[model samples]
Target: MLELRPNCECCDRDLPPQSAEARICTYECTFCASCAETVFAGVCPNCGGNFVPRPIRPENKLLKDPASTKRQLRSAPCGARTAA
Candidate 1:
């Protein structure tokens, strides 16, 4: 299941469970669409992978499988480090 992280790792922007602006990599690294596109150019800095829009879990299903409240932030600002 997707962790549906609560915030963008790059800019620390709030991304609620249903936010259309949320983007994620295969590793589940989450970021806002702005960071994912403009800052990172659709590439995940942490995993060197492409990003895709995060799926929103249905409201009913969310009760059982809740969106993650744990927010993840990168140690450095967006684009601060080069992909390995």
Candidate 2:
């Protein structure tokens, strides 16, 4: 399952797993739409693949399994929010 990361890796914006601004690559490296579009040019820094909007984690589990709260990375937010 995706970590449903709480913040964008590039802008430190709250993602909350439901925000349309959240973007992710195949590896689920998270960023905000602004960063993904402007700073990254749709290419993930960690992975060269293009990004897509992150799917929202449901409020209630529809299946037996559920997502975990583990964070995969916490790199410094790239540059400034204005860049995003």
Candidate 3:
């Protein structure tokens, strides 16, 4: 199951469970659309994989499988885009 991380790993922007702004890599490293597009250039910093929009769990399903409240942030700001 997707962790559906609560915030952008790069910019620490809030990304709620249903946020369309959330993007994730295959490894599920989450980021906001801005960071994923502009900062990382669609490439994941932690992994070399490309990013895609994170699936939003249905509201009812969220009650059974809760969206992760545990926030993750990068140790440092994602500065430069890495080569894909």
Tell me the TM-score of model 1.
Answer: 0.90
Question: Candidate 2, residue 12: CA error in Å?
Answer: 0.6
Regions of candidate 3 where Cα sits further than 4 Å from its true position: 80-84
Stretches of model 1 off by over 4 angstroms after superposition: 79-84
Residues 1-84 of candidate 1: C-alpha lDDT, one tens digit per residue: 898999989878899998999999999999999889989999999999999999998899999999999988898667643321
Better of 1 and 2 by lDDT: 1
Residue-wise C-alpha lDDT for candidate 2, range 1-84, written one tens digit per residue: 776776677666777755788898998888888888888899988878999998876667524545445544446455575433
Residue 73 in model 1: lDDT: 85
| Clashes by residue pair, model 1 | none
Question: What digit string (tens of lDDT, one per residue) describes model 3 on residues 1-84?
Answer: 998999888777889999999999999999999999998899898988999999999999999999999988788669643322
RMSD values for the candidates in order, in angstroms, are: 4.7, 3.3, 4.7
Query: Ranking by lDDT, best first?
Result: 1, 3, 2
| C-alpha TM-scores of all predictions | 0.90, 0.75, 0.90
Superior by lDDT: candidate 2 or candidate 3: 3
